[model samples]
Target: MPPAHPFDFGAIDDDEGDTLHEECGVFGVIGVTDAANFVALGLHALQHRGQEAGGIVTHAPDVGFQSVRRFGYVRDNFTDPETMAMLPGQLGIGHVRYSTAGSKGQTAIRDVQPFFGEFAMGGAAIAHNGNITNANALRRELIERGSIFQSSSDSECIIHLMARSLQKTIPDRMEDALRRVEGAFSIVAMTRTKLIGVRDPLGVRPLVLGRIGDGWALSSETCALDIIGAEFIREIEPGEMIVITDKGIESTYPFRPKRPRFCIFEHVYFSRPDSILGGRSVYETREAIGRELAKEAPVEADLVCPVPDSGTPAAIGFSLESGIPYAMGIIRNQYMGRTFIEPTEQIRNMGVRLKLNVNRALIRGKRVILVDDSVVRGTTSRKIKEMILDAGAREVHFRIASPPTAWPCFYGVDTPQREKLLAATMSEEEMRDHLQVDSLRFISLDGLYRAVGESRGRDASAPQYCDACFSGEYPVEPADMVEQGFRPKTAAE
Candidate 1:
């Protein structure tokens, strides 16, 4: 493809680190008039969550459960008439995966998900999002008892556990299986006549249930509901399970449940602006963060501009609170893929310019307030600050909505080492100099919680949130996981 663009990665900055780990995106449909089509549409909306591989498995009276998968984007892998025609059924499940536990080099059609396994007990097809913290330990235990593993995913651990359970019915076995897993996960598994969805005990990931006429759908985000014309239903409670069939949907929880600890990063960096999470609007939550930022770190500037996409709502709130006009000071190129790990420095440097550009007309000669969700390594922010100054911004005042990320995340996010994080090593003034900005302010940790807690209908007042990346109190100890950092390894190194 003509060597791609030089600005694709090198010119980009390491400050573009993902704040949290995302396992994959999941979509399931039952009783839908066009189950395969609905799954296809839902997977399209969740495309940003993962891009390594995609697949769907469907169940019908004639074929039971038929599936097709390939290592590519959903549009490229599942768009053909031949592929879609093979997945005919009124019930189905889909998955888009970005590997966390296994080597991406081993990626093949067989390894792509909706893993179908048949045994003396029953047959099931499963798709999962989020990593199971106990997967490696559990996998070792399962292997000792004669369960053969066909894939390198933690997801297969659940199915093997379900197989080992002595329960006679599928629901009972599923319940037994879930109680054994720990960490963040939203799973959808289907059989010939039944479909089931389950969330981890802490509910660190998002999963919602929706209904469209007689058909029912379950997804990782409300955006899927919008795509399929499904009416909004409540979110799946932490430690809850729902079973769906032609008879309708039924809920259950057979394990001792814990309070929900939804990943706070979802509200900050992930999720679409139009979506609602934990009974709160995502956009409003971010705006509240911005409002709190203005109160906590009032800045002097003529106008406020967000990083684009994720930073827009917070920028708007900051502008309103500070009485600074919000303008489109930076424009994002939506077509640019994520550049967090572009191989070369030159490519990473070019990435900053390709991903976003300073709108000179809006920012020139103004005292600009630049707001972004979070800063990781500080490379891109530095480049951006230099770009704006070159464009005639008199002074650049930087504002961040979240506290400094000093710790690495083990849940599923691919964060780097502690030393690599800018906030962990640099003083506030040092960061300003590093980014070449006039002034800088980061929101306090308490302000973030208050923003969510005080929102009108959110009831975010008392949610158990995973703030380990911001604070040092990780729900689970991850000292052993320090060796698993994302520092690209080479043969000689």
Candidate 2:
């Protein structure tokens, strides 16, 4: 059978189904020839990091700073001839946001960031990715100190800290404030004359600095650098602050040093295959996972095929190691949009099917090895398996690129509670039975860490990767699950 076409049917909203719980993506550029254009281009690459809304804050010599933000995709909101004409500046910062803190309320334009603020010292605007676990605690402290907040996001807490600090420089003020905050974060703040970037001490999120001629760019992923024509320098050290100004890029470390815990999920799921994070290539890392999986759990199959997109690289690695021919067994619908569908359970299910379809020509009567990045709820994987069977695949052998997720994530990614994870409740054999696959395998935790060219011991890269989702070892536990509204339902209670 021929490969299925990837066009969206418009039958369901493009934004339907399971999502990567990304907090946001941040971009900033200074000393660039066309700073606005570079920011637009950078935001476009980081669009996958967010989709709720997008905005840019540009500095104007006469007017100070001006911004244009709209609640929509980057391509949908900015960069037209008219919008581009309005955004004028040589130094600018941009953001694409997903609702972690403010998703419950209105998708208000005000909640969207590059959150512009006016202070006695100077005005500043910030774009942030990651959640502050202690935001409520911090908010109460600020309120007691007589500080007023404009946004509900924990990100607002930082600005309040900045306002209260007596430090002479913006970096010092940020460093002073960051010292008091906890949880995962990568922040981009724009002042009248400087662009300030800060990452949490643990480095639970990603941040990188790139350079092109005299221009300096900071972004959440190296893919953005590739888009904006910036050379990938190196990751901003796990607990470092970088201040970009006309004087050039200055680096600082105000927080006490801690092991870098760059989120491993970036390589497993979040980052683009072309990106390089924490000094390792994402594409190569994923492939290594496949190779490691084949070594760890060899399966008898006629051909190896990935789930498409995220699963392809690992599938290739699996094929190389297992010596099976790799094939494109599934085709994803390209036309899906988040606002394309109305919110209803039935509608959402239909949306998932429209997003993915099996290629009958490729799988009929063949023993197939199915590859995927991770199995979250197992619903998506189950559906894809059923589709492959419907396409006449004789047997579906399932292999995952990373270890089974057994815990919830607090730093950023919105993984379901522990009970929702298939592996957490069931053994591998049980999971195979539930999904009705011929066999099942997942990469080991140690192997996954090594696949990225680092071991899990001393001298490991991304030492602070919040692996709680896969290992049940959280960096910091919530005060109480019930207080956070994540308590599980008892079988009888």
Candidate 3:
């Protein structure tokens, strides 16, 4: 068969089915020269958050509102001079999507974001990261009240709600819309002359403000700001919204603020290592997690090897803390895309090995300690373990940076069904046996909190960050999931 078209994302199977995926990334800029270009760069930096599809919306007096939504990476779709020229504007917003809701593997163009809505005042386009827990109920209610939706995306619910609002300004309409919303959201929206950003009351996802030249930018991560040479201004506080235009910026708390419970996973894996989260370096935090793991679960091993890329920082810390030699025991093929086709069945069965090969020279006869960010399904971990043993390793040990993910994340992360999550079904010992590793250990939930700067660890009275995936103590009720018969953890559980 010939290579499928890039935008034919539905035809492709996910290459990284074992890992969690963030729903999307949002970026917007105002008053910059060709702001769309800056948004593109910002989106490119945030490609790790979402790789399935991307969209950019730009507004100029000449063009009014112009948008391009396409499947595949930003570089693949948005870098062309012709495409960039078409998006000419001094204000723009963009989204890169990995489907958490809507069409699953088979994404339609309509589902790709920077969703635009026409209002009585003007047209506004909004790019949103994070999932709306009450989207289904809201969607049903909105449809009953005569709101027509254009896409299967939950984020589009906001646009429709904005349309129905009695408020005069777009920002006011958004506040009205979001006040009715339940679940996590970090939004970057653009009107003809304004750029706006808002974080959900819980701040379950990330949104940062940055300054680039005379203009300002809002992005999902500070790393994105670095990509566009934007100075990090600070994170958008939970429940806060900022409207930026030539007159400068105005900030407000649209929703009642609750105790902040930012997504802890952003520190573990979702964010770029170079990014800063809650005034701490993501890389440094991961390193701290490794150090904590070493102290908590001390293991004797000949070599401490990272699972590659994401695992490297933690592995370095583990090696330093444990006084074990650090080596690259597994090598990743950097050029490989998440999905690829193999001509033969034999080649197809190679699976994870096609993407990661065991570094035999380093693995042979060595008791290797493999440090990985997280284990979701355990399929990838099992396969990697087998590859290591096949390469003549003396023993294989698995050190996971985060605690086991036992619950599905409803707030913007693409997670497997609860039953499908290996951690959800198995205990630590059972998981170790299932993977057939000599030993396996995950950083304790408290240890993870300490890594992220909670020196005394997670406070049971009121946990600081969202660790629902590990602890099953959801800070926000997943209304949509509960309506579908999903169970929440009881006190005993």
TM-score each candidate: 0.88, 0.90, 0.95
Query: In candidate 1, which residue ranges exceed 4 Å CA deviation?
Result: 1-21, 100-111, 337-349, 454-462, 479-493
lDDT of 3 by residue, 1-493 (tens): 1111111123223335577778789999998999889989999999998888999999999879999999899999999999999898899999998874224544579889999988889999999888888888888999999988778778889999999999999999999999999889999998998999999999999999999899999999999999889999999999999999999999999798698889999999899999999898999999998998898888889999999888988999899999999999999999987556423667667778888999998899999999999998788898999999999999999999999998888887877677878888899999999999999999998898888888433455555888889989898888877877789999898
lDDT scores in order: 0.78, 0.78, 0.87
Decreasing lDDT order of the candidates: 3, 2, 1
Worst 10 residues of 3 by lDDT: 1-10
Candidate 2 clash pair list: 1-361, 13-340, 13-341, 14-336, 14-337, 15-337, 15-338, 260-464, 261-464, 261-465
For candidate 3, give the lDDT of residue 385. 93
Candidate 2, which segments miss by more than 4 Å at Cα?
1-19, 101-105, 339-347, 458-464, 477-493
